[model samples]
Every structure is written in structure tokens, then in C-alpha cells.
Target: VDGNNVIRKIPCMQLLPIILFLIACLYQGERLDHRSCEALEVILKSLHFDFINLQATQLEENGASSLLDMILYYESTTHLDISDNSGMGTSGWRALAHLIKQSVCLSRLDVYNIPMVGYPALSLSKALLTSRLTVLHLHNAQLSGMPIYTLVAALKVNKALRELHLTNNQLNSYQDALQLGDLLQYNSTLKTLELSNNALADAGNMFVFTKLPLNICQSH
Candidate 1:
């Protein structure tokens, strides 16, 4: 969905006085400054939207943390797309992890194109254990090494997630595939798994495909 079009469609009366400024900054592709973040926090407290898209808004660690903090107060948001915010780092991911664990309505999250390497991955992995998220997108999220392994470990026990996308994350290692295979064996709730563009070899693929159960609707 085009975020700008959605913003334009909203009735002006429903928006607070600061909403116009927020919209103008977003339309200009301006990085949200401290003042803007504060204004956005205020706007979010009163206005509720099921889906919120802040993709590529240049939300560095502080901005990301502030936005996620504001979102904690609004439980009506069900789907959140914060993908492509390259500047988000460990702090941002940490805040997101907290949000995932606390949110009552958030069921779908798109972190596509964000770098979730190192400790950030660990933070998110821990959150997944308790998160109510059903659909998660992590395409190109730098989940190559221990990150993939950690994520797989979490999914093994996570019963809430139903759809997972892990495409283009360089998950070709035999151990990584083994971990994922184990996840599939234990996780009965997952219905779809998308692993396109990864270099999982025949040996690695075997560990995944052979473990698929009839309940699993798709794996590609």
C-alpha cells in the first residue's frame, strides 16, 4: 500500500494539529528529528491505525527507539512495517523486541531489508519466544551465521508464528539447515516458510524437505 495515499485519505478532522507537519516531513523524505518524533508520539497516542508503515524513513537508533516506545501505548495497531530503515541498530532492535513481547494486537511484522546481525538478532530471537506475531518477514535481514541458528532455535518452541519469510539471507550452512529442519519437526503451528534465493545445498535441503509434515502448507 502506498503510505502517502493512505495518509491523504485520512480525514483532516481525525488528525491532531501536529499531523500535518508529520505528513509534510514524510512526503519530503526528511529524516524525523527529535521534535518530529515527539510530535509523532503525541499523534499516535490519540489516533489509531491497524497498519503503520515507516519504511525508509531514516529512523536511526534513537528515532526507531522513540517510535517503538510510542507504539507501546497504542495497542490497536495490528500490522507494522518498519522495513528498510538502515540506520536502526541494537537499541532500535531492543526496543522492537520489547514491543513484540508486550503488544497485544501486533500479529504481523515486516523487518525486511533491516540488518539484524549480532546482538540485535539475539534480542529479536528472544522476543519471538513470547511474541504473538503470526506473520514475520525478514528477507535480506543479514541472518547468515549464528543469527539464523538463534532464530531457528526460537521458532522451534514458538507456537504463535504461522508464516515466516527468510529469503536471501545466505543461510547455506549445513548446521543452519539442520536447525531449521529441527524447527519444522517441532513447530506444528507454522503453515508457510519461504526460503527463496538461499544457497541451501542438496544435503542441507534434505534436512528441511524430509521433515515437512502434511499440516505444513508450503515451503519454497
Candidate 2:
């Protein structure tokens, strides 16, 4: 049960040993449930693809870690989805951020239905600072308030970012969207933005994000 030793031994290992263990002291062989996922991990690792959609909400948290490691570390995936999980709380988001910090192949991410509560902003801001992410999806995720400064900083260097989706989240106000407009005014990387079903109704138009190249001061 030495966690450190296990981690140290594996230490970002790629190929998982496809083992058919006996839990009830009965050898099940390929009848084991995890074998399918392990086989998938091996296949993905061998192909060297850059994306995987982990939309299966039922994957256990521990198993998710292994699958994430396989895709991120071995396959160098730049895009991932861990959407619609029952137990995927803030801790999962933090773990994804940890992986993002270490991930060089990852550039875009979609975390569905998770609560942000400032962590997404913080994590993504950090990720954008160190990584080459170009797209992000936080649909239906719980996020309160507009992270103006973080978004500002993120937009400055996030050259790869071309689209942003914040649908069905709590953004508090339009200031950040407007600030995002200002950012788009100077930073031409982003072209499409979706803030639908958010708290963006305040002293502005949706056209602002679309008309970023023109005068932000133009009457709406």
C-alpha cells in the first residue's frame, strides 16, 4: 500500500501490463471487466492519436486517472473530455489541471457539468500561461463571477486559442465578456465565442464578441 513506491515505479509509464487477476481467487482471464479498458489504453497508446473523449461518466475516479495518464502521457493527447460524472468534483478538476501543467500535447479541454468556483479560472489561466491551448469548453459547469484579470492575462499569450465556450455557467456579469471583447480587439486569435445561457445580460450586445475587429465603442 505504499503509494509513493507505486507512483515512483510507474512514474508516468506508458504501456500498462494487461493482467488478468483473480479477485475471488478464481482466474477470470479476459472475462475481467477492466480488460476492455486496458485493451483500449494499449490501442490508443500504440496509435499516437492526439485526442480522446472520456464521456463515460461511470468510470471510477482511480480508473479515470490511469486512463487519463495513458492518453495524456503516452499518447500525447491535447484534447480530452471528462463530462457528466457523478463523482467528478473539484478534485478531479485539480487533477486535470495537474496533468495539464505537465502535458505538452494537450491544447484544448472540455470539462462538462463540474463546478468551477474559481479553480477552472485559476487552472486554465495557469495552463494557458504554460501551454498552447486554443479551445476550451465549460458547458453547464458551475462558475460564479467574471474572472476579468485572469481572462485578460490568458488572452494575451494564448495565441492558439481561437474559440471559447461558456454556455450555461455563472459568469456574474458582462464585464468579462466585454473585457474579452477588448482582448479580441487587440488579440486576433479568437474568432468564435459562445456565452449563451450565461449571466451576460448587462449593458452590451452579443454582437460585441462578433464585431471585435470594429470599434468597441460603437453604439449598440
Candidate 3:
């Protein structure tokens, strides 16, 4: 069935708030930094909306918080794509970290190109310690140098995660690649590990390549 037709089949009164919010979010071909928790609740209860895309929304800290609230408070949302939200700042990342720490229902998270560093990264790393996320995408989130180790630390204990994408974040150094190789060596639950588009020299890439067991590539 067509998606719009499926949406149309829903009771108008039940879906009105969600439709209005989406319309407002789409006016002028831009996603507004606005959210209604009431509307989100209605959508969740009525339609069981499980996926959300807030990509390139120009969302600031407040908007990001609101989105995080839905993921944290609601029980339905499992997959969220917040990629290219360059306007989201420290508060936003922190809020999401908090959500990750507490929410068990969120399984897949995408936050590519949303610069995060320092304490926020560490906090997020700590949150990943107990998170239920299975698929994680952090491409170009400036997760090189020291910050990459934070995630490495979490992956050491994160048995639930299955796929990790760390593309284009300059894993050029031997030490970082070696650490990642060590993680790949130990973490058995993980099936797919993507390190493409990085700044790795031949030696660095080769080091990680050598660490990955042949079965790691074929597991999933």
C-alpha cells in the first residue's frame, strides 16, 4: 500500500496533531526546531510510529532535547536518524547521551556529521556502556585522536551492538588502529565494522586489517 494512503486510513482526529506537526516541520522545505510531546504521544499510541528522521533540520539544543525526550519517554521509537544536524550543540549531545544511558528501546541511532568532543564524548561513551543500541553510525563526528578511544572503551563491554560505522574520522595513527583492532579481536557480537573513508595510511589500515579475523567479515 502507498504510505500516504496508509496514513490517510488513520482516524483524522488521532493523526491530526502529528500531521500538523509534520506540516509545520516541512513548511518552506525545512524541518523546524519544534516538537509537541503531546503530538508525539498521540502518534505513538495511535500509529506506533517507530522511525523518525530529523536530518539536516537546523535543530538547536532545545529542539534536540525535545527529540531526545520522545525517544527517552516514549516506548515506540526504535530507530532515529538525526544526521547532518550541525546546529545541535553540547546540550543536545548531552541530552542524547542521557537518553542513551536510560532508554532501552532505542536500538539504532544515527548521528553523523554532528560534531561532538571532550566530556560530551566521554559521557556518551559511558552511556554506551549499558545502552541497547545494535546499529550505530557516527561518521565524521570528529571521533579521531583521543575521542575514538572513548567509544573503543565502550565497545569492549557492549555485547549488544552488532554494527559500527566509523568512516572518515582519520584513523591514521597506528595506536588508534591498533586499539580498534584489539576491539575487533575481542568483540564477538559485532558483525559489521566499517572503517572506510578514513585517514589511515597503508600501515595503519593494514594493522587493523591484520587484527580482524577472517570470520568477522563473514559472520553477518
Candidate 4:
């Protein structure tokens, strides 16, 4: 059988693995550039994958932006893991926020170790207001007081999010705990909250725990 004919015969559920295999073979240990990302877009445009992992792809700002733009063509993607891309800057982060707000099927996002302290955090918070995301992992993303406050505020009105991870974000202050406590009171959709490695003091922890629901899973 011809390779093209065999691929055409593959079921939709099985096609993702095959495509991922091809991508791995073609770009193993290689840094992705705009041209490479555009080529990838062409390859992926005709296919649908629920999960797209671009972790540690060595993506620079421009390359990251291009990759994000390419992902916009696949609205059916539900889970996106872009963790460990240390070179992504303002434009890349902004593009990611835009993608989140525009995505119709995205529900889970993992952006671990990305710097989301200032404008990036604010942008993501705004996107959360209208996003369909249910699980969000921002571990080690430098989410301290103000950033945490903004994100919690957004979550207050965002009914779609269910799980949130903010581990190692230096959330040690009472105000940080207070914001989270307030979130528990107003946001009913959040079910799992991970706060490990943070130094939330006894008072802070106590305040947040007081408002925590019995059914909700929480760690501090």
C-alpha cells in the first residue's frame, strides 16, 4: 500500500500518535524557528489533536509567537502544554493569552516555569475571564501577591476553571491567602488547588482553610 493511502486509512483517534511520531522523528532535539513552525502548521492544519505538547522545544520569542499563531489554526486542541520555554517573551506571552481567549475547545493549560509576574499575568487573568479552561498549571511562574490577586479576581467570575496549581510562586503573604480565601467564597467551580512549596504562614494558611470547602482538595 502507498504511504499516503495508509495514512488516509488511519482512524482519527490513531492519527495523532502517528503524526506525533513523525514530528518526533523529523525534529528530534532541534530548535523550532518560524519557517519550521509554519511547516508544522501546514502538516497539522488538516488534522485534529486534542493534546499538543511543545515543552522544552527551545522556542525563542519570535519562534514561540509563530508556533502559537500556528496553533490558532487548530481550534479543536483541548490540552496545551508549553512548559519550560524560557525564551518566550512579551509577544509570545501575549500571543498565548490571545490564543486562550479565542480557543473554543482548550480546557487544560500547563505553562510551568514561564515568567508570568507582570503584564503576562494580567493578560492571562483577563483571558481567563472568557476562557473555557478547566485545569491551569502555573507552577513556578512567579505568581506573587499582585499577580495572584489578579488571577483570583478573574477566577471569581470564571465558572469554567476547576483545578489551579500555583506551587513555588512565593505566595507567603497574608494578603495572598486572603485573596485565595475570598476566591473560595465566590468561586464555586474550583475543586482542586495546589499550593505546595509556598511559605503561606500559619495565619495565612488558617485564613484560607477557614473558607475552604470540605469537598475541595487543597494543599499549602
Clash counts for all predictions: 0, 2, 0, 0
Estimate, for each residue in 75-161, the C-alpha lDDT of model 3 and write its tens digit: 556887778877667777787887877877888888788665786678779989988889888888888777888889888888888
Give a tens-digit lDDT track for model 2, residues 30-129.
Answer: 2212344454553554455455556643555554555555665674466776666535445555556677767767777887776555765676677665
lDDT per residue as tens, model 1, 5-50: 5556778775445476665666254676555665565457656777
- CA lDDT for candidate 3: 0.73
* Candidate 2, superposed: residue stretches over 4 Å from native: 1-40, 59-61, 76-78, 89-91, 101-104, 146-152, 172-174, 206-211, 214-220
lDDT of 4 by residue, 13-87 (tens): 898787777678535546776667766764566766777778877778887788787677567378888888878
Q: Stretches of candidate 4 above 4 Å error?
A: 1-18, 25-29
Give the Å error, residue 191, model 2: 1.8
Query: How many pairs in model 3 have backbone atoms within 3 A of each other, for residues 3 or more apart or on separate chains, i.e. clashes?
Result: 0
Q: Evaluate model 2: give its lDDT.
A: 0.58
| Pairs that clash in candidate 2 | 78-106, 134-161
Using all chains and alpha carbons, the TM-scores for the candidates as numbered come to: 0.86, 0.64, 0.80, 0.86
> Considering lDDT, where higher is better, how would the candidates rank from best to worst?
4, 1, 3, 2
Please state the error at residue 155 of candidate 2 in Å. Answer: 2.9
